[model samples]
Target: MGTCACLRVRGGIRLSRVQHNKGERSTLMKKYLATACALCMGLGVAQASQITVINSEAASFVGVNSNESLGDPSNVVMNWTFTGGFNANNVHISGNLTEVLTGTFASEADIFATLPSGTLDIDQSSTGNYTGTVAVSTDVSIATPVDPAGNVSFEFYESFNDGAGTDQIWDDITIEFQEIGIQNGMVNLGALPSDGSLVTYSGHNVAGGLDFFDFSIGGPGVGAAGSYLNAQTIDPVTGDTIDTEIGLFDSAGVLVAFDDDGQDFALGGLYSMLSFGVDDPLTGSDTTPGADGATLAAGDYTLVVGGYDTNFEDLTIGVSTLADVIAGTSAGDYDLQLSYVPEPASLMLLGFVGMLGLRRRR
Candidate 1:
């Protein structure tokens, strides 16, 4: 009978031990759940804040050039359609520099907004890849000569390039233009801007944040006898410089490639490509800060093309106008690769729960 009583007492002690172990396991499980929630929350925030690059459409008033108005095959238009992608598909940007007369403020002003209306949009399919297109209509206009008995003529030359930046590399540079078509309204005007006449030329100047510039025009402003200059007037007419500057469509009627040391576009100079120094907001300087050079990341950007990194004193406007757009149009998109690395808290909770499981099994 005593042995039976001792066995019962021992069984009660074992039962108490098991119950105590179960309580500890429950506490460990709660901790494990909390840790998991925290980890998931952090991951969610990280993913939500990721950055992306997109394509866009934009325009600017770079400068101007004048040509004697000529008939088709000589007097020409260059409607541009820019298309391309970056390595690893990080940036997707494109647009058409077409001859559209929709002169809204943002549309006319040298601004880069978003895609469709803003210039570009990023590929949201995946944070790493992007793609899009822009259509720019480029047409030259031949003004009726002041001399009723005279004709007008003009021609265009365009080019493209990838601007400067660290994480950005532009490749597969393909510039496509629509082949001139014969319409019913086509005129065979000849011997343009007959001597003793005045023609007016105007257009926009565009550039990427990477110090790259592209020039375009609509009206063949000047006849062969005249000249033009794409310039920047910092003080506006006073022609002085301060923190503020603006582009000028110099159809001043001078045929020289440059004036007062002003830069000039070569013959067939529609797509004038050049690099310029971007003023550094941080240091208030034009030179880049690092060897790779200070670069623009994925954000809104206003890029100008005038002067050089080492030659600021000259103040030569590289192209006619400056074009601004989003950094995504150049940088592509932002994506961070992540892996599941067990956290210390998670490990501790798992360990405790595992131990409880073992205890329950026992």
Candidate 2:
């Protein structure tokens, strides 16, 4: 009888231990499943928040130099068919023109005296119709002295010398979204690892009217609209400072923000510096505190760098504080560093992930 009772007790203990082990395994599986579901949910939220460019289009504005004293500006109509419904708020339009000297000029002075200038005015309709008027001014400078033999190639920015007797003929014109991003035609800076990554790139504003660079902001910085960017121009060869101006455009090719001198005092020089999505409270200040600036939505963006006052020609060559480089002028080896910002949404996701990890530990 005693032997039988001992046998029964041993069997009961073994059965109890087996049941406890199975219960532990079930609890572990439940916890793992909960964590996995949370991760997937977070990822879904992130993916839904992303905004991307679904369609793009291009058009050319051709100029004809009639036998008249001044050439005529060409009006080009641009059309876009969006596979996905068009977002008027997100639509951006930008263009660039290459100067092709059809015939030789008489003299160098005559080159500037009769320098060709063109205007590309973008008019957008509520129905997504885009009309551009490219009018070349009449050559009033024809009376100016000329050699009629000398020819020169000059680099000028867009919208230079609007009212003067300068006429422009734009060939190979292209209009589209931020198609000028790094891979398309802008300078490439490689992959950006994180926020505050100081990436340096160099390029020249020569025959190409503008220099554009593409950079990405990922991780926790993907959705923060309050992030700001800082760009400063440095001489690549001598490291001597060069006056640089920077503009930020969204993937849609819209000019979101611009800055001329945002970092003068900190660098203690006149080299160009600009901030995007960041506010500059200090009047006449060159540096903008990243915290107090304009807000930029997280996504791909194009950075356009040019000589100071090299963008538009409202100011004169010598009168305005604009850079001296004008049409037919080329600046090379300009260096700049881009400061990045993280998105606010990324931070929230990170926090949620951390919480999941803690729960799993418990």
Candidate 3:
């Protein structure tokens, strides 16, 4: 071959080798990007499918019971269907108190729930915070229950009010629940108050306004005292961790109110508790104040409670789980509100990406 032609051929071989090396590096980069995308997708799916044990419904109740409680239709019922995935096996549903009806006391009431054979814990808080017992049946299902999980049926009942004349009603009730948090369960709820913000009660010159406090289902199996949680602190203005009342609600929209005088929370299920206790005291000692005890759980929800006047109007308090906070399901339209405190890492990540792009342009 001519010398010039042979040199040209050698140059062509060198060029082809360079092209091959470039192609290999490009393929390697594509693989790395694909892996990162898959990882991000996996994390999103985990967060999307995560399960929340407690769910509260709306409140809807009509008349008041004769004994001075809310009233007859005050009884509310909500159903919680479990689909065997939660690692923990226990569950708890609690309600708030609004106003106790007072008059002729023909009967008394409480929350009734049927579970798939596990322990039951009933906590009651009024003027004095108290936790009590629940009534359970002696059925086989109640004895040896199945794992993976099952469903629970619950209802709230209260005494009837017969007006011998002095019939009165109470107000302020709220409801919430406690259950397991799982599937890569290492949840560092971190500084919740920092993320979402707490409402502070200012001066206690008067006994009314927004009270922020939380009740959660936890005692065993859950992460910490704060896990499966709800919490609230007195407004710093008041600065007196002095006792106060709160409200509770259920999916059906039943209201329950808590009282500091009696130290218990009472309200009918199926109605959102409007207000419970009066600035003034009840008249007769024999008169019955309205208080129907109950527990609850159903689906997506929002809870609100406060004094009738405006200064305390803006203060709405309650802690919620993803289940309670996020409305809607894998399907349908729902309103959800998520509050979080800002984190330094998130800000740093954004700044770093912006700087990298600026450097590339230069």
Which predicted model would earn the best TM-score? 2
List, residue by residue over 84-154, the lDDT tens digit for candidate 2: 22221222322322222322121111111111222222222111111232322111212222221222122
Clashes per candidate, residues 3 or more apart or on different chains: 56, 25, 88
| Stretches of model 3 off by over 4 angstroms after superposition | 1-77, 87-95, 102-110, 118-123, 126-150, 158-177, 180-362
TM-score winner, 2 or 3:
2
Q: Which ten residues in a row have the lowest lDDT in candidate 1?
A: 9-18
Residue 191, model 1, lDDT: 18
- Estimate, for each residue in 65-128, the C-alpha lDDT of model 1 and write its tens digit: 1111222232133233233221122222223232212221111211111222122211111112
Q: Every model's Cα RMSD, please?
A: 32.2, 23.3, 27.9
Please list the C-alpha lDDT of all candidates, in the order they appear.
0.21, 0.39, 0.28
After TM-score superposition, the amount by which residue 47's alpha carbon in candidate 2 deviates from its true location, in angstroms, is 33
The per-residue C-alpha lDDT of model 1 at residue 55 equals: 28
Residue 25 Cα positional deviation in candidate 1, in Å, after optimal superposition = 4.0
TM of each candidate vs. truth: 0.14, 0.37, 0.21
